[model samples]
Target: MGEFAQILRAWRDRVRPEDVGLAPGLNRRAPGLRREELALITGVSVDYIVRLEQGRAVNPSPQLLTSLTRALRLNDAERDHLFRVAGAAAPSSGLVPRQVTPSAQRMVDRFRNAPVAVAVHTAIYELVLWNPLWAVLFGDPSSQSRLERNVAWQHFAGSLPVTHTPEDDEAYSRDLVGHIRAASGRYPADPDIPRLIDRLVEASPDFARRWKAGTVGELRTSRKTLHTEQVGDVVVDCDTFSGGPGDQTIVVMTAAPGSEDEQKLDLLRVVGLQRLGS
Candidate 1:
């Protein structure tokens, strides 16, 4: 096997199933995660994982490597090593990194039992980290394609089924466009930002119009309503905390204490987990 394949196999064997919120299933031959499990957590296809482990897939993108690093719970040194072995450069300091930092991952884990739904998104609003509650409130982001995962893209492309008044919707659209414009300025060298802008401009007339308008803004605390399959209209307060290399925003959604919305949120947790498990 090549260096990339060998290292991947070693790391996969080192990681335990329970370490990444997975159960140790019956009649297992190995103690660590299965290739399928790794593929699932890393958001890649099983065939792709097989090809990667067999050294057929060479030079995986930084984004794909970052996902694998997080899924395997690799430390900083290991992550860099994996990049090197895969014939890719390690993400440099001061540039916008697609990978969520260990500290940020820990923070996300800490809110596991909290009622709030928390998620981290890139400056361009691409989701990178999310809690179970976030999945419960807003469908699982894993189901979305890489391009469809961005908030701005979904909003302009009309993929997200958010329920809001016309005024609120208009304001939200403006905010999304402004945020992307700000991200483009902050990370001028990021190729993904420019590519995303070009694609949106080509595919979405509304997005093209907004881009030309050039109104830069930050996504801040606001109140909005969401329409879910299991639950009806649920109004909640949304807040954004910015950090990380790419100015990633940690979005937290919460309802007022002792309100009806909180009750619905509680029910959503149970129903959502059940749906996910199935």
Candidate 2:
């Protein structure tokens, strides 16, 4: 089978069998849920999912595709890809997996000051664009691996250096990782996703632990504490937006209680000017 078809089959085949509360019977041979059980969760016949993986059926109805996504516990990126294949389009051939639309890129550029990042709808938030504001907030040096750039990896590893206060850092980290984890359930199969996944699972014990939980979440606004080294501890209101197509997202961050971070942001223009002068 081609890489695309193989990736789909492998995604369907692996599941946190325990995550679904299935028995870990001695007879079980695989690491994930059984195909029949998946049918039960998604409310589709297991045989049908089998057909899609086997390349026996193309152009599955949208409704049926949706049902399979629910059943397979697919994430946003995976769901969009499933829709494409089901709709009879060939999978994209980029060496790295991305589905960013021009509209989404424009949105990222528009938020020049806001730390904006657009990701695919799947568990692995595929990266398309990240602005200077994001680089500043995350302490992201110029070099980051294609996989490390994904939000999911950053959230779990806490490897990205964002200037948050001590009191707020843990809470902020937890919510970010949890939300990304929840988002993954929307798409299960997009080629180019699993490579980084395998690498991450091997490199980080924390990520490997959480990944198996199969938690699902929708992007929503909420209050959280963030600690900026320059501003001390402050509350921030975070809002997330769903994309028009391809399940992209826009996240905007603002300082709450009019924190000092706001002052720093207001002064950013001067910094830009001084750098230009020098």
Top candidate on TM-score is 1
For residues 202-235, could you state the per-residue lDDT of candidate 2 as single tens digits? 7777667655765445556655555445445545
What is the C-alpha lDDT profile of model 1 across 182-225, one tens digit per residue? 88887888788889999999989999998999989877677888
Whole-model lDDT values for every prediction: 0.82, 0.54
Given candidate 1, what's the lDDT at residue 261?
90
Pull out the clashing pairs in model 1: none
Span of 10 residues, lowest total lDDT, candidate 2: 114-123
As for model 1, its CA RMSD to the true structure in angstroms is 4.1
Q: For each candidate, C-alpha RMSD in Å?
A: 4.1, 18.4
Give candidate 2 misplaced runs (Cα > 4 Å). 1-99, 113-123, 139-142, 163-187, 222-235, 257-259, 269-278
- Tell me the TM-score of each prediction against the true structure: 0.76, 0.49
Off by over 4 Å in 1: 1-19, 22-40, 43-64, 75-77, 91-96, 165-171
